[model samples]
Target: MVFFKKIVLMSAVLALAGLTGCATKSDKAGYAENVVYHVNDSVVAGAAMNNIKNHLNANPQAKIVLVTHGKGIDFLLEGAMDDKGNPYNVRVQELKAKGVTFDVCNNTLVGRKIDPKTVLPEAVIVPSGVAEVAKLQSQKNFAYVKP
Candidate 1:
């Protein structure tokens, strides 16, 4: 009878150990990966887009938000293109489909005299791109990336 009780206790301990392992796995999987990408130059936007694509490929559940100002907003405009003449809208749409957000700085638009109508539909205009990046990092616990 004592031997049986010892065996039962051991089994209970093993079961609890298994449950603890599962809990750790669940915690890791449930954690959200939020990232903010800052872009202030159109020339680097293409490389940033590639980095974002690779990031998503590595972690499909990542939440990515891009904030653009100055020349950065050019790529998110209607009929925008890279140096090689590849349309930026297509890649923007592709990333949009994969849950990436594009934000344009309204101040840039006003300073550059760009009409809001000319901005791509996939992008939302924010009051300030720098402020948005600060908010994302400070208030929302997002990691910052400038690639």
Candidate 2:
């Protein structure tokens, strides 16, 4: 029984050591090279933007792009507010200051009867949301993330 206990304890210790080593290696792996988050919903748009903020905080050199289309454009609508009635424009501005790019779809604007001028000034009008995603992927090699 004493020998069995010693073997079990040794195995447990080895398992823990292996796990710790893996965790350290994962931390060293660091952030991805490029990340693009596609925003398609109002609520999810906010969450995705916040995720980008967090990513940027952890990886200061990380490249992030937010592609907004369809209903997602509502998030950047002028005077838009969150469920708590907090304006999102300021948050967008803050993200822009941190080098995050916000891309708005012109097709969505026209389809939704929204004027381009009514969007946040920080947002750049793109030709089409779907096309933009493809362009980013093919031309810029950006990873498409639909969060």
Candidate 3:
């Protein structure tokens, strides 16, 4: 019985040793992989969307957050179309499927007089787009991109 107790204690110690570094390692990995994309220009919206697609294609596991304000919110508006006359829904939905989150600025809606109900179904409205981007960078160490 003493020998069995010793074996069990050694196994427990080994298991604990293996788990000791997991928290820090996992945290570092998440900080490195988290990314934020900011879009405030209506003209470059298409390019920005394409860039996000390429980024996700390259890093399938990367966490992507897109924050939009000002004219940037145009693309998320209902019945919106790009210069090619193509609706933005298909691409937006595709990105959403790949775990990309789209955040619209509530301040923009109020300032621009855009109806909140007109925002794309998948997008979430935050209090402020600029503040959201800053929060992600300062608090979560997310890499910021303006593409």
Winning candidate number (TM-score): 1
- lDDT assessment of candidate 1: 0.94
In candidate 2, what are the lDDT values of residues 1-95, reduced to their tens digit?
99999999999999999987776422743555577789877889778888998888777767788998888889898999999999999999999
Candidate 1, poorest ten consecutive residues by summed lDDT: 23-32
The whole-model lDDT of each prediction reads 0.94, 0.86, 0.89
Ordered from best to worst lDDT, the candidate numbers read 1, 3, 2
TM-score of each: 0.80, 0.77, 0.78
**In candidate 3, what are the lDDT values of residues 71-117, reduced to their tens digit?**
99899989889989999988889999999999999999999898999
Pairs that collide, model 1: none
Segments in model 1 whose C-alpha atoms lie over 4 Å from true places? 1-31
Write the residue-wise lDDT of candidate 1 on 1-147 in tens digits. Answer: 999999999999999989877764325543469999999999999999999999888777889999999999999998889999999999999999999999999999999999999999999999999999999999999999998
